[model samples]
Target: MRRVRQLAERTPADRERYVDLLRAVAITAVVLGHWTVAVVGYDAAGRPTGRSALPDLPWAYPLTWVAQVMPVFFVVGGFANAASLAARRARGGDAADWLLDRSARLVRPTTVLVLVLAAGALVARLAGVDPSTTRTVVWFATVPLWFLAAYLLVVPLTPLTYALHRRYGLAVPVVMAALVGLGDLARSTDHAGLALGNYLFGWLAVHQLGYVWYDARRKVGARFPPARGVGWTLLLGGLTVLVLLTTVGPYPVSMLNVPGEPLDNAAPPSLALLVLTITQLGLIMVLREPAERWLRRPGPWQAVIAVNAVVLTVFLWHLSAAILLVGGLDAVGLLPTPPVGSPAWLAWRVPWLLMLAVVLAALVAIFGPVEARAGRHRLPVKDAAPDGADRPSDARHQRHPLRAGLAVAGFVAVGAALVMNAVTPREAAEPLGLPVPALLAYLAGAGVLRVLRERPDTRGPTPPASPR
Candidate 1:
């Protein structure tokens, strides 16, 4: 608490506290939503199993419009990426340097998670756990990796995307929306594989809006937040389209994938999800003023900092925490098996979520420090040199195209491996109960990035600064 308070006190006055708040809220919603709706218990065969409860709860589908916070994450990522890139450029760093800086933070903590998962898998295998049980546990545990994979896929392209945002403004997302519609068409026509392209287009489009938010902040200054009218427009326009799509149009109402549904809106996103993004964006904007004001207080702001400090760690391991608890309880036969969505089940959620929160808190304590340390090294946008007087020489921070390409390849490999695990968890989590190929890919990616970090600049020596 003291550390959090001190850090909060040290934050730059100009920093957008609300962005951090938004990130914290989005991730929190994801964690709680997953925990609340989870159906984890032993099957009739006495094997541990789990699935989402949404399939059985048709009444809960509309709630997903509020619960699906992934788009908000992308939007926040976009804002942060744009700000960080601007700060990097202010320091005379090239896109490659910026990429290295950004990717390193994500990769380091994730490496810890990958190794831990693999080690646990090995233990489970050696302990003679049932193959199917191990596979099921591992699958549930690694479910969150999909978000990391998707985010990593977009991180490298920020420089180009940000450039496009500057050149084209709202047209960029408009075109992306059109492409998403086409992807939906392909999906409706049975080209599910081709429709996967929406993953990139849909997420990138939402991310582009973050750039718009940043521009609005810059244009209006910090005293006033972005216009509320814009928020209303997005809220109304998006909500109306979303209603139409789910009700009259072809898309399902649930923002998440419901098993046995012919069409899933989330896995390979859809035009409907894009529209949901618009609605969510407006909602956040509308709330931004009050949110920002509330965040101004030391108590609320400190809490936000605490959460943001370990946000990535919390996200990476929350599901694992839940799975661990479920396994332990199931082994002892203490696990409850209320019917899905029944009043008894709903009553059980209170304790279920409470216990999961306790376990997740422990996990965060163990792993969150690594991410916090990595974050400390990130370039601070608020503190960036406004006059560019402190900018480093290009010769000192040389851009290495080859090294950048290799780093990107490494990230791609890691992301692809993760996506494979997310898509086919049973197949990917094999042998020692871990996704060996994915683990190796992650290690290789981390190693390549490390080498990139250690490699010396070759663009010639930087001259010493003259005494001013």
Candidate 2:
């Protein structure tokens, strides 16, 4: 037991290969999920409907298991934030500055993307295209922007959440779990308050698990090696929960299958999702070493890094690019209006999805450098010591497991608020154009990031510059 405890004390370094691999995988799943659902259709009045034509593919339902990969993203986010916060604190940096830097990184790239898309929509409208069509296209294309809005809101609150983690430890996960369970029950019973809470509490609960993992790693250290046994247990447990909920319980497994009313799992998230996160995290842990070795190869690792750098951009613009491809194809009379659930429709969708990716890549390639430059903020850097040995204060901040966990909770709260405001009766009924909610969300997120970035630095004693 003493040996095990000692091993646990030796925490691994910050750069965990498995986490990066998981992030890449998660992003790919998101892109493919969007592609699977990216069909172009016309409504009853022969106008374009925002539904995908390939909904009936045999593989579509099963894909949900892999397609609902957002939980992995949150898990990684928790880990990153936690490690970052811890590192910064050790370097005598304030929580505020750490929050500000992260918030800026997330918001800047996203804001540029939004402005460009909004401009394109405006230009299309002015060029005599059907205004309604243009509006719908823009709205559907920008759906992924919601993730950015949620992330920005959460990044600033990492310090508070991390504090909670430090105090409560595993109890944090237990409480979050109970909240999720209660929220699910409320949603099942049609209670508005409970339903709303479930939406915020349920997913946040899973995100908090990321903190749990980080803390456990810190505590268990080398003894808690990423092993196959842990991975299998988590995977089996998650699958069991998913089956129980979807089949025995009242919840639906198909997150995207909301038809009449919005699906419970589709919105705020459900208990089942929390299980999914566990399974994913476990699998990632088990594969950490091997995955890292594979990724070390220049060809694969470089691609992963490249994708990581522009992940937010790709997520935000992929849908828009899909809409553009469909519109262009339809305008040129090369493809017929897509029919929902038709095999022929599915065949065409493959190429359209590819076309969308190509066009999006082109746009990113052209404007990416400029967009990056515009978003860059100049931070003041200090010098190193004379012996070429850097002072402890000069070390780059490591992520705190606690801060990352808190950031997840913060994101969940902010995302829920934004979603509720946008979808509530009052907002829904307002005559504000379709794009208004999205525009407001983006602006609000940007505003929050700007505020966080401007907080006073409380870290004492700046280090001197090293001799050039």
Candidate 3:
């Protein structure tokens, strides 16, 4: 444990850019994937079917390779957890408080969003909309809520997870691999006794790998690249696993595809996912320097950073915007039913998707300010130390990365599990719950806001020197 602590402290602060860029890329992929899958359909009663029309697009399956970016989100999340924990520990703060503070920051905004959406759904139903259409809108609107639950489950378990990472080191991967293999075997034989553990054990395993990478970066610094030979080997290994699982393995390649079985890789995720994470991590490591360089550019990087700040808002509202656009357009008699799988039908969808983006942008423009206002109270202002004094003993300064990580894991695990059990029993306890991703997005948005608030603007005009 002492050795691990020392290693975690060695890396400088600027080494985190790669992970941030990776996060930006991952969120973008998710948005695009959702857009591609958006299609307008209706039942015989003239009500919207709330399903995608482009189900047969040749590019849909292959999109999974790039669009299934959730693993990368977890990896970056682990990195942020490590950094925050280490910062807090150095300031002499209690690990529990650090975790609690972060948890509140994540959960508060999400609760606001979910409650708002839920209320809207209820009102819509009372307006006499078809039951199926109302249900579809509500379900799609709540998709982003699953992240919140999943993340809350993981947040509280951070301490235990960090301890496991320290004690087991690379053995963490081995254990996760075993869980995946065992889960797969059980799933194959129609026994899902251990299936409930996949979200925690399986995906958490990948998050733990992010911890390993975080520790590794601290030891070697950002500029140090992995040997070319080793990098290619890991890359090839990840791709090989992905190919086998998608093509030959019982699982389908389309990460979005819903299987009939109780255990769906698209939902809670499976071991094959860790392979994808490993591959992504290796690829990031190989291009770390270049990626960092690219991200340093103000024009593009600023946009990336801006989007990162509002990623949660985007994820939670994108589907709602799409649904609204489709329903609104259909009411105006601008769209008519077309044969499925036809080029003409798909062409018609392009305009609606664009309109959806506009609606989403409008929502962001309006609600973004509201969310920011709410976020201000939820996130501790970085510049505002306790009593405005630079107390080293303050919680912000004394947080340890390992402890913070553990606290986060613990909070998320307990909170999400409880929420899932209460709301959606079948999907809640499993990976399909909305709590995890919502929690992550909430945390990330809060973290970014805190960092931005705390960080001094080095590029701005120089202030007059204070008299001594």
Candidate 4:
């Protein structure tokens, strides 16, 4: 608590604290939602199984309007990335340098999670544990990777997308939304493969909106968020379209992927998800003023900082924490099995959530240091001259062609591996209890990125200062 206070006190006066607040809220909602709604246990045949209770709780689908907070994350990501890239460029850094810095933060913690899961899966397989059971557990543990995969798909393109944002403003997201709609239409007609295109376009659309929000903050000053009317407009308009899509059109009302649903909103991201994102953005904007004010208080601000500090770790290992709890309880034959959505189940959630929270806290404490270390590894960015002259020296901005290619290849490999695992979990689980190939691909990519990040300046010996 003291450390959190000190960190909160150190926050820059000019910083947009609301963005951090939103990120904390988004991740918290995701964690709690997953823990509360998920059902994991051994079946009568003694086979492990897992599923979301949202399928049985039809009444809960509409609640997903607020619970599915991925859009909020992407929007906050956009704002943060736009700011980060701009700062990096201002400090004479190029896209590769920025990529190295930004991607490492994600890749490092993710690497830790993947390696741990892979090792556990391998050990389980070697112990003669049922391959199917191991695979199911691994799948459940790896659920968080899908979001990382989607975020990574759009992260490397920030430089390109931010440039487009500068030129086209709101039009960038408009075009992206149109593409998502098209993808949704194609998927409706059974052209499922064609809809895969939205894997990038849909998330990118929500992300681009963050760029818009960034610009709006700059224009309106940090004290305000666009206009209240703008928020209302987005809220009503997006909700209208979302209603039509789900009801009159063919989209599912649930933002989550309900089993047996022919058309779900989330897997590849449908038009409905995009609109839900818009609606969410609207609600966020509408509340930003009050939220920002509340966040200024020491208690809330410190909590936000504390959570953001290990947000990725919390996200990455939370499901695994649940898995650990379930496995332990099941081994003792003490796991609860009330029918999902029943009153008994609802009552059971209190203690279930409490136990899960304790386990997740322990997991976060153990692995959270890795995330902190990654943040510390960031290379210092040089500030501009006092006169504000450009100082993007060759050494600072340029990259060796080979290193550059390797960086691109690294990113592509990581992105492709994650997408494959996310989009095709069953296939990724073959030959091992884990997604070994994907893990290898991620490791290879992270290795290249790590090498690029740590290597000395490739420009070689600094020319001696010319005689003044």
Off by over 4 Å in 4: 219-224, 376-401, 423-432, 456-468
Q: Residue pairs in steric clash, candidate 1?
A: none
TM per candidate comes to 0.92, 0.78, 0.76, 0.91
Candidate closest to the true structure, highest lDDT: 1
Which of the two candidates, 1 or 3, achieves a greater lDDT against the reference? 1
lDDT of 1 by residue, 37-148 (tens): 9997666886667888998999999999999999999988887887776666655556566677776578887888877877777787788866556666677787888888
lDDT, candidate 4, equals 0.77
Candidate 4, residues 282-331, lDDT tens digits: the string is 88779988887898898988887778778899999999998888878888
lDDT of 4 at 177: 81
Give me the candidate number with maximum TM-score. 1
Candidate 3 — what's its lDDT? Answer: 0.59
- Cα displacement (Å) at residue 446, model 4: 0.9
lDDT (CA) per prediction? 0.79, 0.58, 0.59, 0.77
lDDT of 3 by residue, 1-468 (tens): 332233224323354556656776887777767776655676677766555433455456656766778888887777666555554444444445445555544644555565565456457657764444544555666666566566666655655676678778879867877887787777768777766677677767777877676566555233324665666788888889889987788766666654343446645667667677777766766777677777666555555545655666776677778767777878898755566667776676677567778999997776565444433322111211222122344444333465445545545443544454335432232222234454454445445434433442343322221100
